[model samples]
Target: MNKYGRQSGPRYSASTNSAKAPATQQCQKCLEFGHYTYECKAERVYKARPTRTQQLKKPLKRVEVEVPEEFLPKREGLAAKILKDKEAERKKNKDKKKKRSRRRYSTACTHMQAELRYFIAVVVQQWKQQEQQEQQRIFTQLLFRILALSLRLSFSFAFALLLEVVVRIPFSLLLEISVALSLVQKQEQKCEQR
Candidate 1:
């Protein structure tokens, strides 16, 4: 009996008789039309299960086999050719490094030259400013010296004029005293003769 408690037999429907053409039958076990499920030819393939012998079988292990030197492929001059190629690559890398270094050196030189020019220009400007300050200092000192000399000359001339006035006053008083004495003497002699 099947799982549904039905006998394992062919089932027919009313539609099978009404159809003029014969209907194709399919087997549930093998999924093929034309035969019933119990009469399927692929029953052994679908119902067969693995035995303990098959389950216990181990997988195959790989074995290494040595090849003879005579059977190996030949590479006669390949090592020399590889050496030459490596040398060429090394030379190319060295040339590239040299070019890069040359470019860097030229750029650094130009940068240094520009910095030197700028430094010189700044120094020159500072020197000119310092020279101008020195000249101004010298001119100021000369002007002060001339002004001091003129003041000294004016003070000396005023002092000389004051000394001449003081000396003339004393001399004039002495002359007046001498003239009055002479007049008094002449009056005394005339009184005695009388």
Candidate 2:
């Protein structure tokens, strides 16, 4: 069975196989058949033949012809004059280019300077703001530390005072009681002697 689940055999129709076909392959250029147009020798020879324009472009041997005196211009320094005019024109163009470039460069430089100034101002402002914020943070931390220390000191002092009162009050009362008992014993001994 094939992929579509049908029995596989010859798939072409009989009519297609029975159709008339060419007896020989013909070249499109020469129409002479064993090869295609690209391989035809006659087409290559025809392409290699030079056209009329190429034949005319071949250089002719030089032959000088004398110009009549009446047809020639009377100016003796025409070539020097042409050279001077060309040099002046070139200088003018060079000067104009230099001036234009200078103008553009100056404008660009001024704009860049202004931009740099604005950027520096912005950066300085940001730095100052950050510094102020840092100072405030440090101040707040110091203030908190000072308040905590004071609270701790006050608590420690109160605890020490309380501890002293708790210990000293009982000790003072015990000393007074012992002193009073010794004085009463001495008086009793005196009365017996009498």
Question: Candidates' TM-scores?
Answer: 0.28, 0.29
The local distance difference test score of each candidate is 0.50, 0.51
Could you give candidate 2's per-residue lDDT for residues 1-194 as a string of tens digits?
68989766545476664444354867777666666554467753243657788778975678999999999998769898999999999999999998997677567646644553443344344444654656544433433332232222223332332333233223544454345434445544553353
What would the per-residue lDDT of candidate 1 be over residues 26-74, giving only the tens digit for each residue? Answer: 7777767766665566853466756778756854576989999999887
Clashes of 2: 0
Model 2: residue 98 alpha-carbon error in angstroms: 0.4
> Lowest-lDDT window of 10 residues in candidate 2?
146-155
lDDT of 2 at 63: 100
* Residues forming the 10-long window of minimal summed lDDT in candidate 1: 146-155
